[model samples]
Target: MDKKHIKALRKIVGEDNVYDDKAHMIAYSYDATRTRYEPDAVVFPRHEEDVSAILRYCNDNHIVITPRGAGSGFTGGALPANGGIVLGFEKHMNKILEIDMDNMVAVVQPGVINMDLQKAAEAVGLFYPPDPAGQDYTPLGGNVAENAGGMRASKYGITKDYVMALRAVLPNGDLIRAGKKTIKDVAGYNIAGILVASEGTLAVITEMTLKLISKPKL
Candidate 1:
């Protein structure tokens, strides 16, 4: 990226969040695959609006954007293979917004770790069932991107089955919401279904409302 482009990015996310030096670039270059495809810059978005602005600028400049979570995926989904911007979410956007026991749903940012939610739910006598092996380290967003499933999946189901709603930014920077929090509120096209396992191809997921079930007695 040119100096002008870098300056613009820094303005959107602040200098501290935009990295282009060799060290930072190298660190974000590879995931579990260990295959390196260095990005020109790595940008961390602190909120959903930051993501919208960044994607808007990148779209206007024709710069590629690769959305990433914890970088624990076995597949190279988080790699900036085309080399532009690696939009990292783990830095600041890793928040669990709300856990509504009334609805048995949890609202979280894309950077929330899988096990974190599982523990949080279990503490409340509820269960977030999709448990990928990397649940200890993997982000829930990455799990949804991959449609990941683990041992409990045989009886409980996978990530897609638990996702109730999503707020995402499209390639052109449009912020959109798909699905609803209530299971009975299904009245639109399955946009959330399409985004599941899309692996950041369709849009960049920012926040999600995930369904939870009552904890089973062992």
Candidate 2:
């Protein structure tokens, strides 16, 4: 990206929001993979709209975008395979929107911590289920994109098992939502399911709508 594009991105967020320093860029270039790949810069968006705007800008400019979180991925999930932009979602998408006790569900943003949700659900006499190894810091966005699986996957199930809907930006710069808050629906082609395990390739997730359930009393 040029100075003008970077300036535009900074305008979308703020100069402090964008990181292009050699050191910061170097640090973000490699993930847990130990493999080296550097993107021109990294942007930490503080809101859903910011994420969508960043993706739209990158996509429009033909710049690559890799949606990342926590950086705890074991398989280079955060590594920019081909340099472009690493859109870090940890700053934004971090709110737990609602807790519907009547329906036994909770709405959360993608950047919400997995363990935080699990604890909150338990506090409300409910359970969030999808417990990955990195429960402490793994962002729900990465979990959804990775369609993360875990020990409970064989029984309770994986992240996608509990995801009911999401708000993501496709490569074409459109902000879209898939799935629903309803208990059941067979509406369209299940774009929701497809986006579940896409690993940020198909698009970038700005927010997510997950299905929650009440904790069974022992």
Assess every candidate by TM-score: 0.98, 0.93
lDDT of 1 at 37: 94
Measured on C-alpha atoms, candidate 1 has an lDDT of 0.93
Q: How many backbone clashes are present in model 2?
A: 0
Please report, as a residue range, the 10-residue window in candidate 1 with the lowest summed lDDT. Answer: 67-76
RMSD of each: 0.9, 1.5
lDDT of each: 0.93, 0.81
lDDT of 2 by residue, 1-218 (tens): 57787788899989888887788778788766677788878888888778778877876788888778877787787888788778876666688888788877778877889999888888988888888888888989888988887777786888878888788887877888888888787888888899987888887887777777768685
- lDDT by residue for model 1 (1-218), tens: 89899999999999999999999899989998899999999999989999999999999999999988777777899899999999988889899999999999999998999999999999999999999988998998898888999999999999999999999999889999999999986686999999999999999999999999999998
| Shift of residue 55 alpha carbon in model 1, Å | 0.3
